[model samples]
Target chain A: MSDSVLRWTRPLAALVVIFGLWQLAGRVWTFPGYLFTPGEIARAWFASLDPETGSAVLATTLRAVAGFLIATAVALPVATVAALVRPVERILEPYIGFFFALPKISLLPLLVVWLGYSDSARITMIAVSAFFPIFVYMFAGVRGINPGYLKVASNVGASRRERFLHVVLPAVAPMAMAGVRIGVAISLIVTFAAEVVGQSPNGLGRLIQDGFSALDYDQMYAGIVMFALIGLGLDMLLRLMTRRSPGLWGEGVPA
Target chain B: MTSPSHVMSTTTVQPTALRVEEVTRTFRRKGRNVQALAPVSLSIPSGQFLTIVGPSGCGKSTLLQIMGGFDTPSTGTVTTPAGPVTGPSRDIGMVFQRATLFPWWTVEKNVAWALRCGGTGRREALQRSRELLDLVGLGGFETAYPNELSGGMQQRAALARTLSLEPSVLLMDEPFGALDAQTRELMQEELIRIRQAAGTTIVFVTHDIREAVFLGDRIVALSGSPGSIALDLAPDLPRPHTHEVMRTQEFLDAYETVWACIRDQASAREPGRSERAAEQDDQGESA
Candidate 1:
């Protein structure tokens, strides 16, 4: 195998070894009282994914996705407008900084009181948490385009729209990707936090909360593991997407 | 006084290529005005290769920058076919001291981008870029990135990118100055060949006397501090001037004359211009 493949193989082997140990610690060792194996977690995961009955797993994924999409939709336009206009950017800058400084978890009670203890409060919390990082990343990307690139556009007699489409937007795409990755992380974190605080009807966070309440340690660990794995998957998908966009991340970064 | 309208008429009547009239540059550094170039005037006819040679900090690069419309002179004006050089014009292509290729682009893409900017379709641009890359002896390396290429190759790609525009006036600021001696010579010959083929009126800036003499139809020698044209040496050497021309007695004579002029200016600029003048006065009286 090539050197790159060899490097990957070593990491893959280490991962397998770690999982094998985890399985041994849980199953083969026969540690009783809520200590379940990977097989048990898998079985539970499959059992909780029935579409007709609306599984706990499905509800969890849906809630997170819904919150993420809402946050991104609102944040993207706000951040873009803030980046473009100087006065607006100044007006929003202090507010954004203050909000980012304030912990979203601390505002859970206020969010519940205003939006109620339903999915609305949970989603609002998730959006609030996810929104800032995306806003920051998007703004930085837009502002970071070199003056020289704009000069190039002007020299070439490009119209304002042409310059934006060709140079400005393309230059900011990498930074936008960076923002998206950060947003994804925030989305997952806030999703879990929301479930814990608001106790949303369906979600991994709810499952974990219920498991912990009942002292079902294995179920809580399984939910935690599932959350981490999904987040990792999301990050990988974003990385691949960024790599594919030639106009943005193609420079210096290896395929 | 040449009427601006008359100048504009003659230039507009037919592409005048490039013209700088009494173009002086001044800088307000630390609340004091330093005149880099005194009022200097020159006209470059189309298809003529004009090289400006001067000592370090002689504002040769400054003059080139003014001509390329990269900087504005404090006083006087520059007139080109594409109106007053208020900003960088597509009709004028400029290559700086360093190759500033977008690191994200492949060598082919970098060259192709110039054409893409010029409104050519991507397919056609890619084809033209490949031919241009081949012209610069970067053939078969289209897929290679800028980082993969050597310094000389990178400069050549930069040259290719500038030429891809097919601009009427090509402004190069020491394009080959950063290379090894052998590479510089080879690149200079390649540039001459390319300029001849493209019929580009080039304003090449250099500190090397031989390189200037080898390349330019007319060499504009600039002086320091308040940079002004000290000499405009027109080499009437026979056509198809090659590297061998540098070995000729005529070439050597011209080099020596240009060197003497540059050396005097360098010394004058070293110890304040006033002190140099005083020293000159003492030597004159003693003689």
Candidate 2:
């Protein structure tokens, strides 16, 4: 009980100290137009809570989640196929390295030209940005399964489908989940980036962009704060899910 | 340590459960052919406990893997009563050195998973797994994840999973080798009890001679550069084995015989083993 209390209190204390110091500093100095006190940011967030914040939150969430799901759907099967068939791995080898090294954000213009400055382009951009991390982790996960596991599967006379579903799926789940966590975070980042630079008309990215243009520092801070909160919420949700589920952990000995 | 039946699994007139005919294993490593095991032939009778003992470099584990059809012999065949061993089957279950229990699952789920592979329904399989867990002394640990359990408990869960298949033969490759001494001893006793209840033929592989003498009705010792059976003894030790049995004259004599055979192998160099090939064999993957 004490440990759990301490867990929250320590981080909360640190955050309070940082924010309090920032607020005090703002009061002592004549700040620039682009900067706002933490108090002013909170007031701005409350004022925009109804339509502005809600719509932006919804738009950003939809794009990020859709892109994350799409990326997972593609990366998982591709990784499995690569693990199962040696030739597929050989074929994907060069491209996996090349695409991983290349910055995915640079493809936004090409995507904009192909799909237009719409949600589709933004969603596609998020997925493209998220795919490499998911694929890299998932590929490593699938390839690194213990040979003993497959031996046990066959020894039990499991059919091909059963082996895939029971052994392969569960064995890769922990690592895949790790990939999904990173992918989800990447998805939100890409969504914000796509919205901001690509000049999307909606989303938290747009709110920040508009705030910057109007010299409303509080609004920009509010948008940034909301983005951070959403990221924290999603991460907490994923963590809660892993803890509740039994099999999505480090396989006893990484075997 | 004993449960009930097959306490002495008398060697004579018992039908053969597993027959390995002149089996040899050769591994091709970096364009060089490495012979892991020389010709090995053994006939294991039904419901008997057969332990294969050897030094670390010996192909005891390789031989056990072949018995389970996890690996194929380079030059021979392993036959069971059903047919020649061509592939892994539920009839021949295997328990590995590492517990290898799926970390994502509870103990019950891990055991039920094996039954599920054999087309059992989920609820029924889970109920049956409870019974198997009870048999392995994990009665209340059904909902516990593998990681939550100790090394011994994990092995118990693993054994329960293997037993869920109701295999005719159990091929164990150093299942208790990773456990501490006390846990290893405890598992050994539990294994004897479990084997009695299960009444399946078991081919357990380990490098411990004392373990072999304690557990097996028949013991096969493999040692030296390339693996071959150095000693095969059927000791008439006390049944319903306990630690006290280890102090018996019969047990001591059997242990002495097997130890002598292995000691001689290490002391004297075998013929046709070039120093380079022997070094490669020592560092080879088979063990």
Candidate 3:
């Protein structure tokens, strides 16, 4: 076999084995109505490539992206401030701890009540869920920098702005990227959960919820497969972006 | 006692490049006061290579830090030609035992960044970085990240970065200590070449007695616990030092003298004569 084909053989074989067993169980065993056969799920997935399903995918993607952007936009500066100032960290510690500890899904009802059943409530919930992880990672990254680097910067007569731009930003970038990766997954998850629980106008989550209600197990499974693929695709995209700057990934790539 | 007028007259008679006037340092750790360095005064002339050697925990680093203006002296002053050293200045550059390069930056950028911090223009900083890299024999490795370089190469790049600021004083704390013996020797030779070319005053701190004699025009050995300078000797070795010079009798004698001074300091801390003899036996086994 060719190198590319050889590389993919293990994953492909694993997929075939798992799906074969799942299909056999679905055919022979008595299971719940929600349980779907692999063939049925594949057919439904192909069928879901219509304009209606496309719109649902777009809606969910937009909500997830928006939540991710807003979460990072607010979290970056706030985390930076908290890391630099001990008093600010003290002030925010209890609230961040409380929110981070609470189950974010439980807040969906309260968000809907406060912000109404509009897209705003769903985005807010996703943003809230995604914010803590990024903030915590960035805070730790900034705090954990080697004091030697700062000493060298000062010795070189670096100004406050220069120190932040050259030393602090690059030093903390890897950890912040790790946080962003986590935030990407959390944003997607919170968006989907909010859609199902809040019954939003259009999304993959709503499609799955409606399919389940109408006893269309195949369509629900198709939506689930799409969710997994989207999540994986976004994660891979993040990894590729970081690979371009190998230093942020702690690798010594040749120029 | 001599009046302030008499001190001023003495200071005026001979101008010093760097002066440490009774500089002392004390730290409070876990509610206990620890005196790291006692009142120490030293005056170094321009373009002199001075090395401070001591045993572990003798606060050689504390004294170096105080001299570099990275730490404040408890009740004394360090003054340069410009004025009192209150904070870190561009005139003095420091190199640590570890390379401490910003891993994210390529070799050229790391050097260039130091120049940039000193308000050099971007293009000029980069141009200067290329020249310094070449000077340090790292010209082709300009685009390589720090981790790609060998340990010796990393320290060479760090030296280039420190030199980029055009500092008149270079303070190094065991800059080649982490390298293997062969690499450390090569780095020491490379340093002598660079020092001659730059003509910067150097105050180096190391625990290695041989390294102290090899590098310093004058060696100052410090005693342990409330560290104070115990012995100050000038080796009087010829300039443009080479590997063959290490085999010379003068070099061996100088090394022996420094070793004896350090041993004496260590043995003085021992309680009894028998214990001191046992310590000497242990040293012999180690050698």
Which RMSD values do the candidates have, in order?
A: 7.7, 3.5, 6.5
Better of 1 and 2 by lDDT: 2
The residue-level lDDT of candidate 2 at A90 comes to: 96
Please give, for residues B1-287, the per-residue lDDT of candidate 2 as tens digits.
Answer: 12234544454467778999999998888997877889999998777889999877678878888888878899999998899999899889999988888887789988998998899998999999999999999998999988899999999999999999988889888899889999999999999889878888899998899999999989999974468988999999877788789889999999999999988987675555566765555446433
- Candidate 2 A-chain TM? 0.92
Instruction: Show what share of the native A-B interface contacts model 2 retains.
Output: 0.83
Candidate 3 Cα misplacement greater than 4 A, ranges: A1-39, A252-255, B1-15, B268-287
Which candidate order results from sorting by TM-score in descending order? 2, 3, 1
User: Given the true complex, what DockQ would model 1 score?
Assistant: 0.21
Note the B-chain TM-score for every model.
0.88, 0.92, 0.88
Instruction: Please list the C-alpha lDDT of all candidates, in the order they appear.
Output: 0.77, 0.86, 0.85
Candidate 2 vs candidate 3: which has greater DockQ?
Answer: 2
Model 3 Cα displacement at A183 (Å)? 0.9
- How big is the positional error of residue A244 in model 1, measured in Å on the Cα after superposition? 3.1
Q: What is each candidate's DockQ, to 2 decimals?
A: 0.21, 0.59, 0.46
Which portions of model 1 show Cα errors greater than 4 Å? A19-55, A70-89, A146-148, A243-248, A253-255, B1-16, B24-40, B53-59, B98-113, B116-127, B142-148, B177-182, B207-213, B221-227, B235-239, B245-287
The alpha-carbon lDDT assigned to residue A240 of candidate 1 equals 82
Native contacts present in each candidate (fraction): 0.30, 0.83, 0.72
Candidate 1's residue-wise lDDT over A1-255, tens digit each? 599999999999998898788887885576676766666777665654545224655666677778778878988778888988999999998999899889877888898999889888887787788888888988887777665555556555566786777677767777777777788888888888888888687778888888899997756776777787778887897788777645456355322
